[model samples]
Target: MKLNSIISERWSPVAFSKKVPDDDTIQLLFRAASRAPSSFNAQPWKFIYGIKDVDTMYGYLFDLINDSNQKWVKTAPMLALGIVETVPPGRTSLNRFAWYDTGMSVGNLLAQATDMGLYVHQMGGYDHEKARKVLNLSNVHEPAAMIAIGYKGDPDQLPREIAERENKRQGRKSVSEFVTKNPF
Candidate 1:
């Protein structure tokens, strides 16, 4: 089946190069994410990112990752946390679709990064409360996911098990399994 180059080419790589992406490229990613549609245009997504060569940000974020993820994610040149505001500014009720909107924003970010020859690996394996404290996030914000972004690196550099998985081609469920034309 045919697919758009940006969509087809995007894959989450466990190994990443050490080269930090420039500030302009990073901002471009946020710009793409900002364009995603949201419930009532609330745009609840927010990101906290750190480049490897920068200050202590990378280390602090890295430490919050679970042990399994920490093994490989440290090699990534950039790290970010996706956050969603449970209650949007100037609103009284909870934003029911906040997490869904945040995921859409991340989708845009992934596509944009792929178009720029970068790869992104997003993980749910992190300490949420720890992230909240470290980032000084208010009670209104929820930690959604952690993202490791950088250029793809040599799979051989990864640990044996991870390398094997990374080198293998991934598969997806057939469309028939998930798509439906009428109510079941």
Candidate 2:
């Protein structure tokens, strides 16, 4: 069976080129993400991004990453922090689906990036509190994940262990494994 090109083409890579995406391209990515649907149109997703050489923001985001991710993520041309506003605007109650909605936004961003010949790798291995502190964020905003974005690079240039993994073909579980008829 065939799948959508954007869906099939998207893959997270530990190796990334040092060439930064242009401002227009980055804006396009954010535009796509902004179009994602949200509960009650809350649009709780937020992104903090930085391009290498544009400012010191990249280093600030990089510092929040764990040592392991830092090993390969340094070469990425752009970095972003995904966050969710747990509290809806002008409301006190928590939005239980905030994180889920944020993930959908990221999905939109990733699809747009893939269509544009860019690659994105989202990592959960980061210091969440550090990111919050670095960004000077309030409690209402919760860090979701860190994203490394750039063109794909030579996996051979990666560290031995990472290179080994990058060289292997990726596999996913069959739909049958996760789908069910009706029973919970």
lDDT string for model 2 (66-172, tens) is 99999899889999999999999889999999999999999999999999999999999999988888899999999998999999888777879987767666899
Q: At residue 10, give the lDDT of candidate 1.
A: 86
Assess every candidate by TM-score: 0.95, 0.96
Worst 10 residues of 1 by lDDT: 161-170
> Tens digits of per-residue lDDT for model 1 on 1-184?
7899999888888888777888899999999999999999999999988888785888888999999999889789999999999998987889999999999999999999999999999999999999999899998999999999999888778889987768666899999999999898
**Candidate 2 clashing pairs?**
none
List clash counts for every candidate, in order. 0, 0
Error of 1 at 137 (Å): 1.8
For candidate 2, which ten residues in a row score worst on lDDT? Answer: 162-171
Name the top TM-score candidate. Answer: 2
